[model samples]
Target: MSRGYNGTEYFRNAPGLLSVRLKTRLMWDGRLDGADLPTAVRDMVTEAHFMNADGRLIQERIRQIPELLALWREAFGAQSQPYGPQIFVAIAEFLKTLDGGDTWWTAPCAATR
Candidate 1:
């Protein structure tokens, strides 16, 4: 767990924000309501000792990257602009696609089955 100045500890895995998307409560303490993933992501990004980034500043920084902008436009179309909500939602959706299969630990387990 990563501890902040105020002694708020957060989990590193952030599983609810990753593979397990259906979880209701997030963070190590489970204080954040997980009903809305985008909102949760926004909170994480702006939280102290976390990303601590302003949404508009993040948007502008992302917009400055042409390649990233092009990729976002291609993947989500023009309507889905790279604003704070869209960026966070897109990142969450992308993280959901990453499977922890085929690792050494899983491989050994699979062979035994």
Candidate 2:
């Protein structure tokens, strides 16, 4: 389990057995950090679908998906490629999948209304 600065439980029901860096970033973006990545991902995906599709953030988000995050954690933790460029193309491909509609890939959990 992890708690946000506000003491809001970002992730629970799972113990600390496997709280990898990727999970931290995902929950940070999608749930805890107030980064609004899910909203940003959705917006950028829409723009890329119908517009220039060559923005820095859009490209960055592509690189920040789950698979790449996992790859980075493993590679970095193992002292492999210290920097991350191998993930760029893959992330771009992922962004390509975000064509206009809402992508469930990084959708935030529905806030309590």
Candidate 3:
């Protein structure tokens, strides 16, 4: 006989709750694909991933946390003293000035274009 509504089944567990205790961790050996940002910056990004991560960083399964690019944008965007907004305005104007609206330029450094 089954105690049908006793709710003692593992299969009836709450969604996303089962994986909640399974922490995801991240580990990196510090490799950089681009020459512009420097090793330190790249390493900082990787370290941030681990530092901001939970104990399960080795599993590398965190939610949508910001990546390096997003981090840069957010960090820069939040700055005051007119530098960030000034540069932002200049870039917006510059992008508007583009003829083709696209360029095959290396990011974080436009000189490579």
Q: Which candidate is the best by lDDT?
A: 1
What TM-score against the true fold does each predicted structure earn? Answer: 0.67, 0.19, 0.18
Candidate 3: tens digits of C-alpha lDDT, residues 21-74? 122321132243322222222232334332232223422321134463354456
Model 1, CA-based lDDT: 0.70
RMSD of each: 4.3, 16.3, 21.4
| Candidate 1 lDDT tens digits, 9-111 | 7556444333446567666677777556666677768877667787898888878998888888898887666788788888777655655544566565666
Model 2 — TM-score against the truth? 0.19
Which rank order by TM-score, best down to worst? 1, 2, 3
TM-score pick, better of 2 and 3: 2
Clashing pairs in 1: none
Which ten residues in a row are the worst by lDDT in model 2?
A: 14-23
Residue runs of model 1 more than 4 Å from their true location after superposition: 1-18, 33-35, 78-80, 102-112
